[model samples]
Target chain A: MGRIPWRLMFAHFRRNKLRAALTVGSVFMAVLIFGFLRTFIVGMETSLAECSANRIISASRLSLFAHMPKSLEPEITELAEGKAEITAFTWYGGIYIDSDPKHYWGRFGTHPESFKKVYGPDLILEEDAWQKWTDLRQGCIIGSDLANDENLKLGDRVHLTGNIFSGEVDLEVVGIYRSKVRSFDQKTLFFNWDYLNETSKAAGGRKDCVSTYCMLLKNAADSGPLSAKIDAAFENSPHRTMTQTERAFQAQFNSMWGNLPLFFGILGGVVLLACLMVTTNTMMLNARERIQETGVLKTLGFTKGTLLVLTLTESLLLCMFGGLLAMFIVQSVDGEILMFVIASVPPSTIWLGLGIATALGLVSGFFPARLVSRLEIVEALRRRA
Target chain B: MSDNALLRFQGVDKIYKRGDEELHVLAGLDMAVNAGEFLALMGPSGCGKSTILNLAGGLDTPDAGTVTFGGEDIGALSDAGRAGWRSRNVGFIFQAYNLIPVLTARQNVALPLLLTPLGSKARKEQAERALRIVGLGDRMEHYPNQLSGGQEQRVASARALATDPRLLLADEPTGDLDATSAKDILDLLQRLNRENGKTIVMVTHDPAAAERAHRTLKLDKGRLVHSTGAAH
Candidate 1:
């Protein structure tokens, strides 16, 4: 036929309503999940890409879990020779009333003044919030997302029971910070490192120790020499330190989740393949039902190519419609849905998901279209009759 | 025969295999259908009445010899080429009506016209004309399920006539219809032949339906065993 009648292709759906809906619904869920999971990997990648090159994080040489003595900061400061400003980070992994990951946020204890100065650009705060936290003994600044999730107002008390530092700690909220640079997470609560040491000393636990020392260099080029000097200074000490650029440091944290891009790629690929198989099965069922109709079309002078096009178009339409809907749904989704997993699905990921869906449609549609093309007209007509 | 024949089969053999055994559906069949003729093929079940129809329409190829239309060997054409040829020259009406349930009578009638160069408006107009010819003008907008058995068959007839094909093949067109509906279909077929000058080859076991044709041929085990002069 010159232009194959689209209605004929659409008729398969009209005749068997349930099968068509199910096929489209499967495609929708596949695209949605793929896009949703892809957001996490994309977010991690974005954060790693945005890390400041000028900063170096000094951590325990043994592992992320091992802590280095805070006294080592002065040795690193001397090695930098006034070329860098230093602050320390103590990861206070804590749980709010419940232990669910959704209710969790990064709790870091760092020198309030030095942390504020080092991360000046990343942390957006009110001018008075810093002065208030500076004056208050037990004050903390929380991320914008954490403030919103916990609905904590300024001067409101926030309590946490820590795993690393032990016992319970209560603090007043002094500020809420927002960050465009993702490495400085928006879901963290930064408190005075002295407060953590004091509490630990009071509880008879080890004090004046930190997870990482963050050194902000005056020149980004000095990162290499400064990092090497800092490592060598603590190499033989009981509290040995490993030092790297902030970018590499953030990358190491991301590596904790394995090869992120490959992990999500494989996860999404598996979902799409599973979707293709399901669509192929659905298409096969449709072809079986339309065997007689296709034979009649053949008898009416429809070529094998025309029949194949018809079948493929049906499959493509289902996937395209579902994928387009899923893409939009991912774009407009509320941040709370993936609160702990991902901040939001980026535009690039949405387009990528749609592309994957379209390819799945074309490849999946081919199997059944090939079957339709090879059907013997007489055999089909006879078989159906 | 060469001057007048629209379709010709010479020494044709068709065999179908069932696992290990071969069924010879047609054996050295020889026949010709002249232009402007109404020919009926009658036979018992499994007697190859429909096989000849299938061969005539280029739906299947013969194992030996040739089936030609207007002196062109259909078996020689590629599958796609034959489909084009069928679109241009052949129209078929089936016993079960075989109408796509979703399409209206006019749309079903316009199916073959999609292969032509006609614009959508022209195809629609031609489909309406065909429906009116089969006395179903009022039912043109109705779908197959919405119409009665006879009306559905009339829509099928309209479909067969829509392309203005040189040959029309009906495979027991009234097999599923009541006697009244069957007679109505036979009357419509007869009118198409005697008035419109369409060349039709209809397959049927109904002697009553066969009597409306200009001539009747009977097949037994794929061979022409009996023949009757023009019934009209």
Candidate 2:
């Protein structure tokens, strides 16, 4: 076997500068988009997986937006008896700074007393943060990251303009808490459910319902049976309940925006196809222009396999360089603002993208190399084009 | 033809297919060049002169007869085997001074040596020696684009000589050069043949180029119509 035509192929790129750069750029864009998309899915879903296995989330069977009566909380608690502690969990879509999306963070209305019992294991808080949240009626706890970003501290007043429901709301930042789990985003603002109810009632809107009931089981293994028992108790009521483990509930919550994973997968596929087309087109042009040179090498006794390996390797190296660089940027930079979940992409996801790069390189390299390698020497020499 | 001729073609036939057209390029071509002979093939375009070189160098197979080098049938070898045989026995020089544009003169000359078992140091020594023989030792590090037309051809000739093969094939070696450059290349060829006793088969249309050889065979259509040199 002959050696790889390393220097020759390297110089070919120098001969066609714009084409090579464009090809590499195309590969870089494809890899960057694909990596970010996979990271988004993995970061969000993996964090959801960290939610305690002992917790069960029960929502309206008809729709996530359907209101469930808060009066059934005690009945659910009774059904679980010693098995669980229960709380109300309601999403609050509020604009913190006018309507700019960049200032966005989560706002959830929950029963602060039971909220701690349900989520205590994952929370890291100041010594008196819990007491302050319970002692003050209009007090709320902000995530440590959110507090730091907004420069908010204890006793700091925060104003929110309601978007989903009517009327503005005001609350004091009573505590700054950080979460041990990323899926439970550290940039959320959690307040008492009773505070929201009293504010709405004073504004001539009586709040009688909660969005969902969260039950934290005493034993992790009892989550399934306890969830079923609670749901069965409310099966014949006016508003039916669908109860599931928190992880399953989070999956359903993600599906509320549509099949995000499949959408991103298809988007990534299209980008990759475009990358393949561009790179293959450039490689084919390179191969065609050098057909006579290939003939010259063949006459000098370079075997078909040697030429094929050399050509294929050149293409693969170019694409891999672009791909590996894109993933490196994905790692070095924070994408929390873009991903809206966790910022840091996992190393596993980077390795997976590299696998995609290798496959992309091979596929894009094969056809052009095969065409160049399979030509007869006499014919190739005649092909001056 | 002598039974011990270094390169022999016996009743060789070559046909080319172009879409629907069947072109007969060579028909029953019987030729022989004894060892140490300098032979030339002259003809118009499409007359199978280059085809004969391709078969002799094992770059292409004949449709009908045997092409043998030193009594071993090269056409009978597999693709890989023929490539190996060519690397071991034949060197090729092209009309366009076909040096790789990317490689320095030394690197281009070292290409065929890559097929040999010689270490890098040995290959480098052989390439430099071959370049020095062609009087381009000073330009060994220059790329083909950096060298003149005649100098590039010298580097190509050095590449052809780097492996020290027994047979050399030159197809229109001076077809693309000016008169001065052409003469210098022809002189180098004569010196290699005389000093190294290398068997050479060159294909060219110029009578002056053909005159440099010991024998000249002229082809019209696909058959040899004239032979200016004595038949072996």
Best by TM-score: 1
* Model 2: lDDT of residue A95: 88
True contacts recovered per prediction:
0.86, 0.64
Model 1 pairs whose backbones collide: none
Predict model 1's lDDT versus the native. Answer: 0.85
TM-score of 2: 0.82
* Residues B14-130 of candidate 1: C-alpha lDDT, one tens digit per residue: 999999999999999999998888999998898898999999999999999899999999999999999999999998999888887778898899988999999999999999999
> What lDDT does model 2 reach?
0.85
DockQ value of candidate 2: 0.53
Candidate 2 chain B weakest lDDT stretch, 10 residues: B223-232
Error of 2 at B214 (Å): 2.4
Q: Positional deviation of A254 in candidate 2, in angstroms?
A: 2.0
Interface RMSD of each: 1.2, 1.4
Instruction: List lDDT for all candidates, in order.
Output: 0.85, 0.85
Worst ten-residue run, lDDT, model 2 chain A?
A: A332-341
DockQ of each: 0.66, 0.53
